[model samples]
Target chain A: MATAAYRDIAIHLGVDAGSELPAQLGYAAALAAGCEAHLCGLFNRPCLPMIRHYIPPEVIERHKAECERAAVKARQLFDAAAQAEGIATEWYDMPGSALETVLVQARASDLLLLSGVVPGDKTARDYDRETLADEVVLALGRPILLLPGAPKPGLPKTILIGWNGSREAARAVHDAMPLLQRATQVTILCVDPEGQRGLPGAELARHLSRQDVAAELLVHAGRDRDAGSILLQTAQDRKADLLVMGAYGHGRIRETVLGGATAYMLGKMELPVLFSH
Target chain B: MSYRDIVVHLTLDPRNAARIQLAIGMARRFGARVSGLYTVPPPNVPYYMGEYIPTELIQKQMDEAQTASVSAHTEFMATCASAGIEHRWLSSELAPVEALRLTVRASDIAIVGQPDPNPADPASVPYGTDVLPHELALQAGRPVLAVPHSGSVTEIGRRILVAWNGKREATRALHDAMPLLRSAESVHLVTVGPERKGRTLLAEITEHMQRHGLRLETAIVDPAGQKVGMALMAEAQARQADMVVMGAFGHSRLREMVFGGVTETILSSMSLPVLLSN
Candidate 1:
């Protein structure tokens, strides 16, 4: 049987550094408890621009104090949540660049959980939320579960996988095996532009069958409609709690030069999305 | 994961029977259905050379290939029947590597044989037979078990030694081998390198395994100037492991070919059955 479990899960806590437990943490803890995994909370010090000399000393001191306080609060909240969930836990205070430090620390993690919500506060000053998520998704070499803006009450029971017969798509499907095996229902969505194959998703469905996942296949015509829109519409229509798809891109370029569906989903995802590059 | 769809590639080599028996044993253990794949060699003569060759000679070659394919199929079916497991047969005219690549995606694992170091009749060996297993391991996106041609491997996965390094390929291979690891009588995660780095990586992986209800016997070997592949094989033999599991092609293929990588060393010098995934 496929191992429907993750042994190590790490959550990004740098953005939600307030004195409260973020929903992603609670969700991560619950998942850890379900699989007996060790949950690690990774919080990196806030990144400030190098123009510190031009800034006032008092402002710098105030920012430093706030960051120190946030770190302590985040640790306490993380510990309490883990205790509440009753799973093994670890806390790390990363003291370097945000993305690099998190990557170095979470190298061995099976899943890295990050919030998809970028703070809308105009006055907020911290790491660049837009690029951080993209960088991690591309460079982590592990699966990333991007949480919705609002937390769902429980874990995902229904999963919709986007398959396009590409290497990235194949990797995403395989990496999402643990979740797919546990989902109550799985629907494989294949957007065949040419509609050449007699049955679009039969091969992948057969492959999943060997792993004991009975999935329904949904094939759609690409006639004039963009793939990203088609996927998003299907996901919404089906009320899928989770979307599993490949985070497609090369280097620092976004979907403009590469995968349009990935960019669309990343920007407008209403449900939790699991992405593997 | 437990493999339910198992594929064994059959050729005309003498070690073909041993490979079939190994697949049957595995199917019996995992409750899997075996599929015997026999790929017929395409016409040796190119289109340009076709006009120069005699039609009678071409017909004779085609007849011989058909005879070989039928005999191999018969033997595979008989072996599966006596073993009392579900089985299927697939014959393709595609090249051996391409056929296995397409067929293995739908299957859980592939059972292939190591190339014979010296063939009794080189002419009889099909084209691309020697490099089939190695190429499949790198490009097939599935775990492949290559049975050594020299020895009779009656028991596998009983005692497994995993060659570990904290790299992406190794992590993938370890996860793909979980089904076998869970059932093994004993498993050892062996790493050979600097002491501190090895110990830390082993500790993390050991903890991960512990969560899966497996207690791994850990080892950090001192290479002492020995090559990584040789060191790992020596340790597996010393520990009496029946099987070896490791990643394939950690470096780029071109770089490995030029600089001599660990994966090449193991593939050429392997004595026991090796499970490899990339």
Candidate 2:
């Protein structure tokens, strides 16, 4: 079983200032962390040149004031959310690029909180937001909690482990230990096993036992199915609300060649999966 | 390309049987050939006698290992043939990565099993050394598809997630993934962090893909108050993406920033399979 690297959960609240998702996710983090959640707010400062361009030369003296005013408003909103959750809150104002600044701060936090920004079109510009999120994940080396719209009432109860005997799987299991320990039922499913000797599920079961987390291991031997399809089926059969496993395989150069199981699950599995590399 | 000619690498340990079967199934799907390579320990000499092991003795052991490898490959190919796929087998003493790399060099792809699930346990041997998929990826110079020791999969490539950052690595990944992206029903270009001014790199990628007739959607996220890695995971879930494509970011020896903050975050905490290019 793995523990999250960080104890603090940092929520990146967009400059929109009024979005409800940030607060909702904040409350969820508070509940998940119990005593460990540290809620913080970050404001995206416009680049100095952008600010200069937007404001007239005569009003340049007020530029600093305008930035401060926005920061103050963001702080107030973040403070309000923290107060509502009855947790301590911190605030910071970032300059230059929002993603870069947020990433820098994320280095010190345990988990990152974000709100999904839907692309208005399929064009390149629309991909900016998605690219930024992916970049943060690829660049930061931490886990993120995305607030789709609103936060759910509780953490996942039924958990699924995508048992692959890979370093990534081991790391994912370790990362997910915190959540797995609290889940009501845990299932470790191995998709294909015509001749394999050992399964990851058994190891997970043992790890859970040490932690006193109850879990069950299931080995599904599918002769011809892809690993991903098998995992999705097992998750569905087990009624798992969350899936835990290692993010499988990669291609040589750039393309991600998902191990059959991971690729399939990503495509069709609706259950939430906790993954780590 | 169809999987018919793909050669998959198999670990010597019997524990990878499940993964091998899954690989055979994939090969079948693509009408590909299947080959199993068994890696053996490097030969050692006895110090007392100051003599090398006899060639006959080595041959006998090699023969036995080859028999087992053939048996496994044959059984797997039987399954594939039954499913109407053409398949074959190859056995060699090369390291698992080297053997598989050679087999697949002129072929289509290589599928390697993940190491044992419990890496902490010393006895497991985690795919017997030569099968470290990451190491293979670094050296293969060809595409390597990694399969988890468990889990079943048949078809691949559907909803694709492109982890776009305006970087050379990201662009390389996009270029490598053209085949999958071209066939994908929907492609999501996910960007993180704060807003950027002027023409963004992600936009350029989107335009390029659009020119290729790919159906795509773009998303932006701010890991405000949260770790960037976690935020991307959340977004990947929200998009319901099957696979993520990005550049393998790391700094050169002299460059301390190696794998910037976001790249490091995603690699350590990635929930989805990320394709990375250096």
Docking class of predicted structure 1: acceptable
For each candidate in turn, the interface RMSD (Å) is: 3.0, 16.9
Candidate 1 ranges beyond 4 A from true positions: A1-3, A15-21, A45-67, A96-109, A117-142, A166-168, A223-226, A247-258, A261-266, B45-51, B117-125, B195-198, B250-260
Q: Which 10-residue span in candidate 1 chain A carries the lowest summed lDDT?
A: A118-127
Question: What is the overall TM-score of model 1 with all chains considered together?
Answer: 0.85
For residues B1-278, what per-residue lDDT tens digits would candidate 2 score against the true structure? 12234556654456446555655655544444565555554433345545656897767756766675666766666766775655555666666666654444334345665454445555446234533554554444334555544445444567777766554445445544555676677888777766462125455345445545566788788878886557776887787776666655444543216435555565445544455443
**Model 2: how far is A271 from its true place, Å?**
6.6
Q: Fraction of true contacts reproduced, model 2?
A: 0.00
Q: Please give the lDDT score at residue A9 for candidate 1.
A: 87
- Candidate 1: residue B78 Cα off by (Å): 2.1
TM-score of 2: 0.45
By DockQ, the best candidate is 1
Model 2 chain B, TM? Answer: 0.71
